[model samples]
Target: MTGPVPENGQHHDLVARLVAVLRATGGTAAVCTACHAVIPTVDGVGLTLFTTHARFVLGATGPLIEQIEDLQISLDQGPCLHAVHHRAPVLVDDLTPTDPRWPAFASHARRRGVAAMFAFPVLLDDHPVAVLDLCRTTAGPLSDTDRRQATVYAAAAAVLLRADADADHGDGAVVSASAARTQQATGMVMHQAGIDAAAALHRLRTHAFDQNQDLAQVVTDVLTRRLRFDPTPG
Candidate 1:
């Protein structure tokens, strides 16, 4: 299992193995736990599901993974978000402070001992429905076989999450209170500044970092009408 799977049959077998485990476990949390056990190269895993309205952190292997997800949520950038946007895997063998893709996220994650990251988009009906994120304490590329397994795990996660969504009418992916508030503030900023979602979120992140305030507090200020984003001049 150190190199490429070498054959399509082997790859399908890997997917079946994980899909079985996912079905037996019957939940996103169990999917993450199982993925962590099987993917030895990764130190932590997080799963995020995106619906029409919002995204949810449906599962995480531990606190480190949860913290990484939170950082991405606040900054509005990271491998997980990128994977979802590109509908493909985003693999970083080393996360360094100078990485231009996500400078702030890379710096903070490196300080937290996350030396590597891999994010795979989970697809259902050819549409990306979620991202499966892996974090490693050591900086190195994943073995080809391990990377294949990660892809399979992400496929299995999509199955489990889709089932969960169907059962609860998608309400199971409850946006956290902070996340809901952040979304509200982002909408407010969008209306005020005549900008899109991405720009509004970036503005919120900038204000939070500049003021040395927590993102939630910044959102609170926006929601309370204490802070506003004025439309920039053309």
Candidate 2:
């Protein structure tokens, strides 16, 4: 017996094929290419049913996804973030009632009606470049078959994202997916510190206004633990 092999053509084709399989299986899934940014693909369209059921639209969904990614980048905690960073899969059976590992995220997810989620990292050369995610409204684990399918899909998605990045940059230039993850982790940390994210944004804006520091640097400091938010005023 031969294992399933990818057909020729850039990675996106493989992703499309995998997504077709998922939809055939009647599961809700989404593919995020090139640093977990949701790509507009066939499989992606099928997965949007879940988001639509949750009331996400193009105008709103983009920011929501960005917020979720940023939370992981800023707080340095989140299944998706870890999955991408470690080039592995991370699954949460439930998000309601809070999980100690990601209290903020869990709470927010629960509020948004996300009961369960699975994040799989798509990697190349031990570096994660994209993610494949699945979710269910019930608090149950994915079956073995589903997990296997997700793994295959993630690998294919990574390849596709890389190809897209290559094409976008032209001439073999490459961008590090980790850079996006780092930015998200940095935002997550400040959010976890009980500092209002909006306020942190204000501080970031002030820093950008007063000093010539890059907003990314300020975010990095917050995430790396170099910057602390003081509750009491001096």
Candidate 3:
């Protein structure tokens, strides 16, 4: 895998395309479907978000990626798992008998005609929020240009994942009416508490606990203006 550093023009073009995908209606699913078309070397793409309990696929480009991501979760091996857990990129030029990192998973991938893989951990505040898996049918590592472009895509994915989590939605789909309220209320707390993102979420959960209320209900009350956080002494 060899190529010159990709020009800024090309990188800018890719970023713009990814932005368009993010703005479209389908959300993560739309981004997954459109990304492969933009990156010629990427034969497939899969996105998975890591929750405290498990890793769930947000979207996948096709059957190949879908199958691979599931296998990674079930078998507990492969590039996606390593990337997220390690908070680093995993690039295997070829999946073969000698690849010690994920021998079992590689065997399965080989049977599926997947010759290579690249996985990047999407990070926020130095923590991995998700993993983006890129697969290829050809046996080789990514070229320099491909790596740079992939990094840009991974960054875009991090932003989208945070947005989805904040909005109480999964990809493009609405999560729930209550969940949406939670999102709005969290924003209110963020404003009142003069805090950053995580602090605002913490306030929401703490307020729910202190009030002996469901998180959504507390959020709803706050959103509807029936309850307010005191920013000053009354």
Q: What RMSD does each model have against the real structure?
A: 5.6, 12.5, 11.9
Error of 1 at 15 (Å): 2.5
The Cα error of candidate 2 at residue 171, in Å, is 13
lDDT tens digits, residue span 14-119, model 1:
6777777666765565767777887877899888777665555667777688668767866768998899888989999989977898898888888878999999
lDDT of 2 by residue, 1-234 (tens): 123444545445656776565344322223433212333211111111001111111111233343444334344456766675566788777666468877876765566556777777667677755555555546767666556556666665455445545577421112233333333543564566456444545454345335544445565676677765554254
Q: Tell me, by TM-score, which candidate is best.
A: 1
Clashes of each: 0, 11, 0
Q: Which ten residues in a row have the lowest lDDT in candidate 2?
A: 49-58
Whole-model lDDT, model 2? 0.48
Lowest summed lDDT across 10 adjacent residues in model 3 is found at 170-179
Question: What TM-score, to 2 decimals, does candidate 2 have?
Answer: 0.47
